[model samples]
Target: MESSLPSTQILDSGESAEGKNEAKNYNEVMSTLPKVKSLNGYDYYLYQGFWYAPFFLEGLMSVQEHFNPQSTDIFVASFPKTGTTWLKALTFAILTRSRLSGSTTSALLSKLPHDCVPFLEYDLAQNPSNRDLAIPLVSTHVPYSCLPKSIISASCKIIYICRDAKDAFVSLWYFLAKQRRSENVEPLPLEKSFELFCNGIANYGPYWDHLLGYWRASLEFPEKILFLTYEEMKKDTAAHVKKLAEFMGCSFTLEEEEGGEVQMIISLCSFEKLSNLEVNKNGKHRPDTSIAIQNSIYFRKGEIGDWANHLTPEMGARLDDIMDQKLKGSGLKLPR
Candidate 1:
């Protein structure tokens, strides 16, 4: 969705040469950024509002460059803070229970989620070896257009997770605020941040467009992309997990459950279980760019209606109007 932030008015194409030079200089300054290594055998530079790894981009450019999608391959795709952690945990647990055979070490099971389902962005950068981590797992925030061309052509099965925009904005706002506070940078106040969020100015945003891209793709390729919502999953995780397992061609057999395997997986990957794990709580997985820590454990509160705590009536109404207009006729309604 577009951020609600005030729009910047563009100058006419006939602007003076001096103005153009100034604009160029401004862009150059904004684009200057630190470089980091990518998981996919390349370096990435954070610049001009997006992470750019020419090599990784090239890797995603070709479907063949991607890990072959086995019948076992499972991909989790989402915009940030949309219950990605929950889905990752559930997917990992479901896939690995047969191997675990009823292990009670919740810590080990929690760790397994990250090990099994590496995020295409965060985890990949720190551990290049993770690029080739086994099949039945990969997660990404990359928009539909940016996904590997081969994935599209091959019709690889993908799970797209979505959440209520209000809850997403609240969680994202707090997360960013915490990061900025750690860095001693002034946090973006809620009103201003909300405005930017509405305008689609947040990281990897143009949020509506990003969501719509995937929503449309899922509609056109229903067999290939299983569209899921965070609210629905939160309401019935086990059922959704079963659906996901079935979609990925890995449904639990009645025989497996006769051994209590399903419950074991569910207990192991529960949010309370994973969030408290020592490895996740204390581990440093990424470079802390001016912040105290990197890769803060992803298992944040997975509660619904979190926006009620942060959004003012006026702001909420404004957002409601925007949602109504943008999502009109799309059969996608923002949860109240």
Candidate 2:
């Protein structure tokens, strides 16, 4: 099986004459964009009323100018902290199951998901290595409006998974809390963050808009996008794994399934197995970066409705009202 890892050259940092001109154009775009302070107190530029981290926007600019999407490329799209790590692990494991020998399969247990399946904007902006873009597995939290033209023009496959909006907010709140503490900054209280999130002021937020963008796209281009929900995936992970394999054009054969290949992929990527791995528990993902984060930070309590532990009745009710209003007539209602 051929690996989807990126080995293709991307014009990173605008070092060449053509690349430098592209960078100047992006710089001009950045200068005119609205900026806002995110919940973590970092500045994010607003486009279409949603906030995007500056670095991510820079990478998006690079991708727009240089990325030549192959029809076979697979992209995992989601809001931040909304089962992205889980989906990436499952997607990689499923796609690569036939490629690895039994002994080498153990490496999947050790390597972090972000290392195996890179984020399009975040990872590429930081490193600009051909390795990250060479892979078939790519991810992004960038809204549809801001995605590189090549992605849509080429009609690349996008698998978008969303969690219940309320739980997604709780997960974002907790994740940022950890990130801020690591940076020695005071984390925003849940009450305050909740208000801002509802008002659509967080990174990649107006969470409803993010979900709707992909959801509507999936409906229109069923061949190009697969929309999923975290609750639905948790309910029947094995079934969804099979669905994902088929969607990615790598369906397991009867012989493979009969040999327990599907189960093997599930076991390897399970929340319990991944969360407890030493590398995940102790490893820092790109520690040198300003947004240093632990591999374990992606684990958390991967349960449905964990938000109940944190959300007051009033808080939950307010979010529900917003979701209902925003998702009305879209045929998209999140699981409670």
Candidate 3:
């Protein structure tokens, strides 16, 4: 548990020399990385051909330099807005079901899934006090190529979840709008957001490239990478939850399986059940930073193909065409 990064805020930022040095390094990366306009007003830096928010870039750099992964560690990896919250909830439940005993509910009832499984880069690496967390379970939005080398070299398992490109974009627009609204800043227009998104200029984006990075890696290292798509999970959640449990090295026992634990976990983490919880509806994930986002933004209509409601036919087909071209001959076909 040497790398267990605690969730509770610890005000040790100015006290530790390592924290200062990490902050200095983060600043250096922030200042030197090539910068571009983000979908919103904040600047995103083009690093390794994809765009990343400045804070997350700092986190990527910090996690790379310091996060030490153990073989037991399980990383839930994905691009933003790709059912990350859902995956985090399911993964946490599967891994910690032993502690749940006979109850259908778990900590998820009280904490946001993001709170239960903190982001390796954005949540932990961005917060200096959380630099060396001892926890084994972590999630990340960092692309596969940019992930901490320790995660790869240490031979840990990664559970990745993806969604249809169109749906992912739709979810992202709503999430961003909610964030900006919370801060009283004007959100980007949907058309403008779509334009930047197609160009691969959004946060942790160039969507096709981000998806392709892990898609290809999962192909090359099937044992180490359990790639999942949101559509597939929504189609049959129980089966996928079982797959996740197995991949995470905690497959349900015959008794547990027969006892309806799988279904219990699914229901416990379902969007409907979670969205109504007072904690999720009213709470805010206040990291040590000044920015505190409403937990409610994380819970929208977790419907597949909600893009139809948001994007026109032309916009949908255009993104699909782009993804098809980008993934052509790569043996990856995104759900249309």
Candidate 4:
């Protein structure tokens, strides 16, 4: 897969003349309408100078109302592209071992993680009754501050997965690049995109604040939130899955051990396995969006320190300094 944005003559949207022209075009394409308040009461911000509704937040409220939080229910939460799909697959396998009988077949596995543990936002928008489906599993990328108060206070378990900001930015860049290209919007140049990302100007960004919010919450309520790192899980998935199972009160049985079910589950949920599945690649869950483009591409690369290939030395140093300044004394550091 092409990881970097294509280098070519393109309009800019920064301080340069070409960038200003691009900005003008973006503004022209977007409606100059007033921002509207969403049903959940958050202000919708302008995207490309047009009022953009946060359908996701609206869906989240719907799911929140329908969710009957139980001690047994598990929620997987993350910032976008922070190994969410992989974590969802691993968690699903761990929780539903008895149902799967150790299979990751396309016929056996759900088309999307959203189908297995639906995104509280997307599903609720697609089918309001979908909220009732959250009894056992749900996943979200909503910031901790934005999540329902009940989820914060309930006995239900939450697993917050985080990734190094550099890698997360690179992954998000590629993900958005694919989306924009598909939508016929010109792709943002890599350098400018990286700058916007570092400045936390992208969608659902201000990455440090998002991660810190969860980190602090987890510290305050350790029993309710289990903070995890993508690097750690990539290093020893089986061990991590086992640890997760233990935390969620679901463990492999002796009979499952005899059948190597734990290892089977890990392999089944591997990046290569899930990314290649026809169901994952071809299935469509969101209206007007291709599953292959949106969900399947989510698992594009799970490699650690992959950002080194994209971020310049100076850029990396700058990011490191910013992270140090923001995360200082928080007892949290990005995994190497």
Candidate 5:
């Protein structure tokens, strides 16, 4: 058998460049990787058996090289459009509520979740000397397999969120469509994107495989990883918030709950409140990057079964079959 893998590029400190042109260096490295076409009509590179969008590769390299995870650090991990924005908001609000309570201002009052709790990969890319790494509240869309070894070695706690395949697919499609429109590129057709999704070629997809990586990890190390579902969180926001608070080791005291702190957090992090906030509605996450996405782009309907408006019954059934087949015997159940 012949190996067709690209030349190996290990994570390096890049001290020689003094952190200059890191993105260019990463792009040069990416040019050498095995490449494939994605359903979204972009080039994805094959790295360690998983495909990744070229835009994220640079930041991922930064994460691999520089992220020195600590046990006290908390991570919010998820596949794209799986309520990641919402989770970040909730977690940040939960953990920082006490510290920020006395201030006249709130984090969410000015910063979006992506701003308050930055993505590990992209955030590190922008600010290589990130001061917050000591006890960071980081988020990432990277698959579990590709996460920096430091994250696992340091035993950092991770909160992983999963969504039903149908809804996730719908949300991902719209998200990508908006992105393409922002860049003045014609959006990938929905039917074509759906086919690619089923074939396991969408961004960070095979969704089931990505879900299983964390699902199995949570099963193996329940203490290190808390598995969550967007549907479940939406169904009982208060209960899930309590659970998240407990897992983060900052459970609300009875006195606080009695004072309605839980409800306060929920209201502050609510989809309606966050989405409509002037900052989130008009701000840009990273305006200078290749993927200069608006904060408002992350706010869609944020509901269940929006797929019904997009996917036909036959299409839904086909995805269901694929999910059933791929997740067979995995002991993982995504909300329907």
Candidate 6:
């Protein structure tokens, strides 16, 4: 394949420019990858058999080269728009509650969930030392197949979240609409995007491949990977939080529960509470694309079965049938 990279990259930043290991050849490497049009008008690359947005590729490359995992590290993994923000907020609150001063809810005050639980393939590579490494908890949208071998071999625990295909499709379309507006490009129409989604052409997709990679992993390593669905968590968040806490080895005590700690955490991380926070409402997050997005962009209705409002019944059935085919005999079910 023809490379756009300088024939040589200082693959190791510490190495001399005159020597080998140059990784600065990102553009070169990126140009050679298999590319496809996305809902937002930019090209998505086929990386390891799945598609990913171009913006995340650079950071992900650095991550692959530099990330060193520890047994104590915890990860929250999910495909886009599958309650990732909420899961991040909940995990941040659950794990940090015992360490904060004053009220337990203080940990989440004025924070975006994305800020609290940084992305492994982006934020961590940007600042590995930002948060004190005390039981480092991070998140990733990277498919399990593409994750750094270090992470796969490490004893770290991973929690994977996914949602119903129809809802996930609707959510991603709306999300990409924001990115399209940011880029000053015409938004990919819903019908067009939905078709692409069904074909597994969105960012971080081959959606079935992304889901099954982790699903199969969670089954093989039950203790290391906890798989949860968005609908289940929403049906009973409190119970889910407890389960999350226990899985992370931080179960709330009887005294803490009696004192209303669990409920307090739930209220503080609730979508209503989070969406209204001044920080989330007005804050800006800069992605590798250098686009400053209003943190509020991440705050959507978050309602389950919302696909009905946006998609035709036939559209839903098409996706449901596709998922059924993909999930058949896998022993995993996604809400229809």
Candidate 3, position 319, lDDT = 91
Instruction: In model 5, state the lDDT of residue 245.
Output: 95
Best by TM-score: 3
State, as a TM-score between 0 and 1, how close model 2 is to the true structure. 0.90
Cα error, residue 262 of model 1, in Å, equals: 3.0
Task: Report the lDDT of model 6 for residue 100.
Answer: 68
Model 4: runs farther than 4 Å from truth?
A: 1-53, 60-71, 104-110, 125-128, 131-135, 287-295
What digit string (tens of lDDT, one per residue) describes model 6 on residues 1-336? 001223223133335663233344666787789998887777788877888776676657767877887778898999988889999988888888878654434646666778777677665765566455774788999899888888988878999999999999899888878766766767889999999999999888978888999999999999999999999998998999999999999999999889888898899889898888888888776533345577888988989999999999999999999999998989888865
Angstrom error at residue 216, model 3: 1.1
Local distance difference test, per candidate? 0.62, 0.79, 0.80, 0.66, 0.80, 0.80
lDDT of 3 at 35: 84
The TM-score ranking, best first, is 3, 6, 2, 5, 4, 1
Better of 1 and 3 by TM-score: 3
Per-residue CA lDDT of model 5 for 96-164, tens digit only, reads 887765323677878778878867766654554553553368888888988999999999999999899
- TM-score for all models, in order of appearance: 0.75, 0.90, 0.91, 0.78, 0.90, 0.91
* lDDT per residue (tens digit) for residues 1-336 in model 1: 111111111112226675455445534543466554322212344443344443333223223233344454567888777877778777766766666535664335445355557665434432334554455578877777666565576567789888878888888777767655655666767877787668655555556666777888889888788988888877776788778888887888988768766666667777777777776676644333221243453656768987887898788778778777777887776455
Per-residue CA lDDT of model 4 for 2-31, tens digit only, reads: 111111111212256754554354344333
TM-score attained by model 5: 0.90
| lDDT of each residue in 257-318, candidate 3, tens digit only | 89889988888889999999999999988644565778899989999888999999999999
lDDT of 4: 0.66
Which of the two candidates, 1 or 3, achieves a greater lDDT against the reference?
3
Name the better of 1 and 5 by lDDT: 5
C-alpha lDDT of residue 212 in model 3: 87
* Model 4 pairs in collision: 12-19, 13-19
In model 4, the Cα lDDT at residue 276 comes to 81
Candidate 5: which stretches are off by over 4 Å?
1-32, 102-104, 126-128, 131-135, 288-290
